[model samples]
Target: MQNIIEVKDLRKEFKSHSSRSGLKGAFRDLLTRNYKVIPAVNDISFTVTKGEMVGYIGENGAGKSTSIKMLTGILNPTSGSVIVNGMNPHKEREKFVRTIGVVFGQRSNLWWDIAVQESFRLLKKVYNVPDDVYKDHMNHVIESLDIAPLLDKPVRKLSLGQRMRCELAAALLHNPPLLFLDEPTIGLDVLVKLKIREFLKEMNKKYETTVLLTTHDLTDIEALCERVVMLDEGKIIYDGKLAKLRSNWGEGKQIEFQFADIHVKKETLDPLLADLDAAWTPGNQKNVWIANVRNDEHIISEVIGRVVASNKITDLKVHEISIEDIIRNIYEEGIING
Candidate 1:
C-alpha cells in the first residue's frame, strides 16, 4: 500500500477576538480591540494509505474541521507540512484540487432550482470530464445510491436524504481517488443513515477510493472505518484500531435490576454489592429499586443472590457497555486511565 495523504507536525492557530456581553461591554469592546491566539490544531501527524477509510472523530470545536480544511487546501497550516497525492496541497492548489473531492454537510454544492441530474451535468463540465466517462459514472452512482427517481427532481424540491445522495454523487463524479467527507450522514433517519453507510462501503470497494471521514456519529466510525484518529482540544489523543479502543475503554459493564421493594436504601445495598462498583436508585415513584452495577461480570447473579437472601426481586437485566459510553468516558477521563 502507498500513502495517499501524509501530515507531519501539523499546527493551526486562530486569533480570537474579545466577545461583547452586555450593552456596556459591547461598547467597551468596540472601543478597545483585544484578541488572543488559540491553537485550533496542535502538532498532529498521521498518514492514510491508498484505499483506506479513516475516521476522524472528536467533540465539537475539537479541531476536526480545522484539520479537514488544511487537508483540502482551504486553509494553510501555521507550521509543518501536508502532502496529498504526492503534492503539497497548499502549494499545488490547482493540481491538488482535481485529485480530491470534498463534501460539507451543512452546505450545498448544487444549484437550487436545477434538477439533480442537471447538477451532475454541470459538475461534469466544471471538472472537464469526458462525455462517455461522465455518463457511465453518473449512472453508476445514481443506481448505487438508489437515486434513479431523484434525478429529475429539483435540488430544492428533494428531501434531505435525497439531496444528500445527489451531493455525494456530485462530489464523486470526477472519480477522485481521495474523498473527504464531513458528517455525510448527519441529521438523517436510521434507515437513510444505514443506506448511506452501505453505499459508501460499496463505493470504496468498487473504486478503491481513500476516504477521510470526520463525524461525531460513532456508528459511522464503527461501520466504515477500521482505523480511528481521535482529537481533543486541537491535539491528537488516540490513533489506533477501533477494536483496541473498545477493548481498552469498554471494559465496564452495566447491570440494571428491579427489586420488589425499597426496604433498603441504595446506600445500604452498596455495602452488600461492594465487590461490584454499583449505584442504586429508585426505579420510579414505585418501591422498586434500579441498580446500576459496573465492572462486575456476576453483577446480576450477585444482586439476585443478595436480594433473595435479604428481600425479594422482581426483574433483572444486564447490558454491555455501549460505544457512546466508552467515548464519553474517554473524553471525560484521559484514555490513559479510561
Candidate 2:
C-alpha cells in the first residue's frame, strides 16, 4: 500500500513564561522577563498507508494532540515536514482541507440550533459539493449510521450519541478520503459505542477511508486498530503491530486464589517463590491472597500446589492481562528498562 501521510522529523515547541509569587518578585520578573522553551513534539516521524486504520495513543501531555494539529494543518510545526496525499499540508492548506475531515470530541462542528439534516445540507453548500454527489453520500451515511430517525431532531435536543452520529455524517459529507477522529467515543455509553464502532467498520470497508484515531479507550484500539503508535514525553516509545506489542511488553496473566484456612506468613512464602516475581495482597475477606504473576503460568500453578499442601484451598481464578494495564505499566516503568 502507498503512503497517504508522511511525517518527517517533526518538532513543535512553545515558549512558556514563569510567574513570580510576591509583588516585589512579580515586578522584578516583569522587567527581567523569564521564559522556558517547552518541546511538545520532539523530532517524531511516522507514515500512514492508504486505507489503514492507525491508533495514536499516549498518556496525558504526551503530545498526541499537538502532532494531530500539525497533521491537520490547524497548527504549523516549528520544524520538519508533513506531506498528506502528495501535498505539503501547511503550504497548501486550502487543498488539504478538501481532502480530509476532522472531528474533535471536545468540540462540535454542526450548527447548534439547526436540525440534523439541515446541518448536512449546509455543509454540502459550504464544501461546494455537487447536488447529486451530496444526495448519494448523505443517503449512504444516514442509512449506515441509522440516523434517519434523527434527521429532523435539533442538534441540541439530540442525545450525545445522536449528535455524534450527525457529526460523523457532516464530516464525511465532502467525501474526504482521509479522516482524523479524536476521542470519537468519549462520554458515550457502551451500547452507543458499539453502534458507532460498527458504523466506522462499515465505512472503512465501503470507502477504503484511511483513518487516524486518537483515543483513551482501549476497547476502541482493540476493535478498530491493526497497528498502534505509542508516545511518551513527546517521543515515540513503541511502534509496530499490536500483537507484537502485546507479546513483548504485555506482562502476563494475573491469578487470584482463595483458601479456607490460610495461615502462612509472607516471609515464609516470599523465599519459597523466589523464582517467580509475584506480589501478594490480602483480599477483602479473610484467608485469601491476590497474587499478580508475571509471564509464568507454570510457576503460578506450582506455587498454588505448594500453598494447598500447607493451607486449605478453596477457589482459584485466572485473568488475562488487559491492554489498558499493559500500557499503564509501560508509563509507570518509563520508556526503557535495564
Worst 10 residues of 2 by lDDT: 264-273
Model 1 lDDT, residue 299, Cα: 70
lDDT of 2 by residue, 39-124 (tens): 99999999999889999999899999999999999889999999998888888998889899888988898999988888888888
With a 3 Å backbone cut-off (N, CA, C), the pairs that clash in candidate 2 are none
lDDT of prediction 1: 0.84
Write one digit per residue (lDDT tens) for candidate 1, span 1-338: 89999999999999989777889888889789678999999989999999999999899999999999999899999999999999989889988999988888998889999888888888888889999998888788888889999889899999888888888988999999999999988898888889888988988999899999998888998999998998999988888888888888776555555667656577767777777666665655465666665566577677667866876667666667777778887888876422
Per-model C-alpha RMSD:
3.4, 3.0
Return the lDDT, model 2, position 254.
68
